[model samples]
Target: MSQGVEFNRLMLEMRSMQADAMVRQKPVASTPEPGAPSFSEMLGQAVGKVNETQQASSQLSTAFEMGTSGVDLTDVMIASQKASVSFQAMTQVRNKLVQAYQDIMQMPV
Candidate 1:
């Protein structure tokens, strides 16, 4: 559908804008507090949230298929779409990270 295409384009544009902003951001190196989460920890948490969203969507779809009461078609559809979008976004992030890693590896010391 055209709407879906448009939505995807918009999402990609937003992601590019975000990446650009991050590229232009100034780094402030400060010592981490003893109890603070590291960068990897935050990334893992984000991935976990994406996984949770997909799992929730799967559960809702299963419930609807089983004719569970109070599970509206609209809600199921929305959940599925949300899960799909999140998964796609996560995939894009992974791709970008891989590309960055490759770029870094190619750089000469």
Candidate 2:
């Protein structure tokens, strides 16, 4: 469904970002590209998005539990699942980042 499509799109974006990072050469100067956001900015934005998703999901669940009109159970469930999936994806990314850092730190000088 739409969720599957969205997830696929997210995965594609991640792959493209990873490839781009790998393909990039070291810059002569410390300054980043004029228009491109820094890695920290991108990471912050992603975290913000996940936080937003979880907050929205929580609000939806609360509305449903309070018997608010026009709040469907299916919609609430879908939001919950989306939030859960996003959180899992973030966790996996964090784990990979940590592992990579450890591997780099353990490298021979």
Best by lDDT: 2
Across 49-96, the per-residue lDDT of candidate 1 in tens digits comes to 779878998999999999999998877887788778777887988899
How many clashes (backbone atoms < 3 Å, residues ≥3 apart in a chain or on different chains) does model 2 have? 0
Alpha-carbon runs more than 4 Å astray in model 1? 1-29
lDDT string, candidate 2, 1-109, tens digits: 7667766876786688678766653576766667776677777877888899899999999999999999999888878888898789889988999999999999999
Q: What TM-score quantifies how close candidate 2 is to the native fold?
A: 0.78
* Model 1: per-residue Cα lDDT at residue 39: 61
lDDT of 1 at 20: 56
C-alpha TM-scores of all predictions: 0.72, 0.78
Candidate 2 residue-wise lDDT at 57:
95
